[model samples]
Target: MIILLVLTVISIIASLYASFIYAPTELVMGDIQRIFYFHMGTVWVATVAFTTVFIASIMFLKSGKRKWDILALSSAEIGVLFITLTIITGSIWAKPIWGTWWTWDPQLTTTFILWILYIVYLILRSVAGDNVKQARFAAVFSIIAFIDLPLVYISARLKRGISPVVFGPGGGGIESKMLITMLITFLACTLLFIILLKQRILYEKIKDNLRLLKSRAI
Candidate 1:
């Protein structure tokens, strides 16, 4: 854990350097484009985090394990945090270019919906508390929420909007340096996610143990 934390810190520093100093400024967007690296990083982490929640939820349903429930809850909370950051960073970048903080572009619309769905999932989890049946219902809802994840990506392509497609068909590819910087940022974000998830799971387990102790005392 210590090694991972140290490495994550170094990688984040490298990512910061790469984003601001190594990558060349975009001819069109100028310095504002630097936010793209951070935006992409957050969105990537959020995608991974939510996917973990989806898979963990499935496992929890199948095996009825507290560990899987802990994992799902941990991932969902981190996923929501990162997705919120994605929206904020995207809005910051969009303001100068699109001349607005927000618009109901297809990608944005779907992302907003995705965010709301997860928020609802979290609420369900909180309300369920220690109720096994309610928790299972929340898990089922999470599985259904997973559907929106892919839609957020495809919405940009299927319905062209203010969001620029940086990859795939109808998109302009990034320069090699910019691509490298993006990869570094992704690495940093991924490591951060892993660290946070592990800590969160550990914390949840501790809470569970304490609850068990209190119940025994009662």
Candidate 2:
């Protein structure tokens, strides 16, 4: 736990300093574009975390192990946190570039849908009576819902109507420095995700132990 916390802190500091010092400021979009670093970082990390949740769910079902369920649950929670930030920051970036607060762009739309699905997954877990049943059901839903993510990306890229490609190979815009900063941010966020996942899993183990102790006391 201490190691994970320390790593997270170090990564956060390094990411912030790197973005400020190493990353070049955008000439076209100006300082406002700096938000992309954290924004894309959050998105990239969240996507990976969520994908892990789906994979963990599958493993849990096959193995029927409580630890796998705990991992899936932790991943889902962290995934939501990162996805929330991704949406908010992306919206902020969109306002200046696209001249709107929100749009039904392919990426945004798919993200929003995936967000809702996870929200439902949480709700389902809360309402379930038995731990085993809850884990089983939620795992199923998680696996099914995550399948939409790749499709969302592909569809967004192929269709290309409302969603604007802000930065990338085909975007036709963006400075090299801005891109570097975004990549750095993404790497930092990935590191943060690893740290958080470890912490959450540890917490789950502690909770399970407490539950066992309480039941014995009763």
Candidate 3:
């Protein structure tokens, strides 16, 4: 864990340098296009978060373990936080480039749906009352809801080439420097997600222990 923290800090610093300094300005959108570095970082991490939830949910279903439930919830919480970041950053980038705050574009619409589904997953965890029942419902619902994750990811590709794609046609023919910067930023985001997910799982464990203690004490 200590080594992971050190590596995470280094990666983030390197990513910032690469995004702001090493990467060249885009001829089309100028420096504003630089938003892609961090924006796409959030998108990548959010995708990871949902994938973690999906896998953890599957494990809980198979093993019927409380820890797996805790992991799924932890991942869902971080996933929600990061997806919110993605939407906000996308809107900020959109305003200057697209001259609008939002459009019901295919990817955007699917991302919105993905966000709402996980939000509902979190709510379900709270409302279920019984821990076992809550875990069961959350696991099943997440498995079902995860279907849209792939939809959100490939929305641009799946479109009939009618709308403009964000990362269009062979990864937008990006320069090597820009691609490297984005990849570094994505790695930093992945490390951050891992750290946060671990901390969140620990928090849930402590909360559960407290509840158990209180019931026994009473």
Candidate 4:
């Protein structure tokens, strides 16, 4: 835990140096374009979180293990947190470039949909009440929801929009220094995700143990 915390702090400082000092300011967007560093970083971590949920959900369905269920739920919680950051930061980044708070752009819309879907997933877990049923339902829903991940990634390509493409084929125009900063920030965010996910899973385990103890006492 200490190691994870230390690494996260170091990465964060390095990422800040890389973003603010290393990268050149854009002529059009200016310094606010620096938001892209952490914005894309959050989005990348959120994507990883959801992907973990998808894989853990599948494993839970196959093995019916309580540990897998815990992992799926933890990943979903972390995913929601990161995705929310992504949306908020993206909005802030968008305002200057797009000259508005929001537009019904394809990429934006798809990302919102993905966020809502996972929020719904979190709700389903809480409202379902029965632990076994909740886990089963969430596992299935997580698997279904992940179908949108790739779609979200490709949304810009499928539809022309004000949103820029930053990855995959046909994606270019980013300078080398900016790219390096983004990569470092992305790594830092990944480490943050690891710390957050580990903490979340540990919390879930403790909660389960407490609930089990209460039942035994009864």
Which of the numbered candidates is closest to the native, going by highest TM-score?
A: 1
Error of 1 at 204 (Å): 0.3
lDDT, candidates in the order shown: 0.96, 0.80, 0.87, 0.88
Please state every model's RMSD to the true fold in angstroms: 0.6, 2.2, 2.0, 1.2
1 versus 2: better TM-score goes to: 1
Q: Which rank order by TM-score, best down to worst?
A: 1, 4, 3, 2
State in Å the error of residue 101, model 4: 1.2
Off by over 4 Å in 3: 160-170
List ranges where model 1 is wrong by over 4 Å.
none
* Residues 134-158, model 4: lDDT tens digits: 7798789989999888888798888
Model 1 over residues 69-104: C-alpha lDDT tens digits?
889999999999999999999999999999999999
Query: Over the stretch 1-218, how does candidate 2's per-residue lDDT look in tens digits?
Result: 67767876777787788677777776767777767788878879878988898889999999998888888888889999988998898788878877887877676788889889988887776676356877699899999999877866776667675455665444656567766666667767887888889889999899878989999999
Which pairs clash in the backbone of model 2?
none
**What's the C-alpha lDDT at position 39 in model 2?**
80
Summed backbone clashes in each candidate are 0, 0, 0, 0
Candidate topping lDDT: 1
After TM-score superposition, the amount by which residue 112's alpha carbon in candidate 3 deviates from its true location, in angstroms, is: 0.4
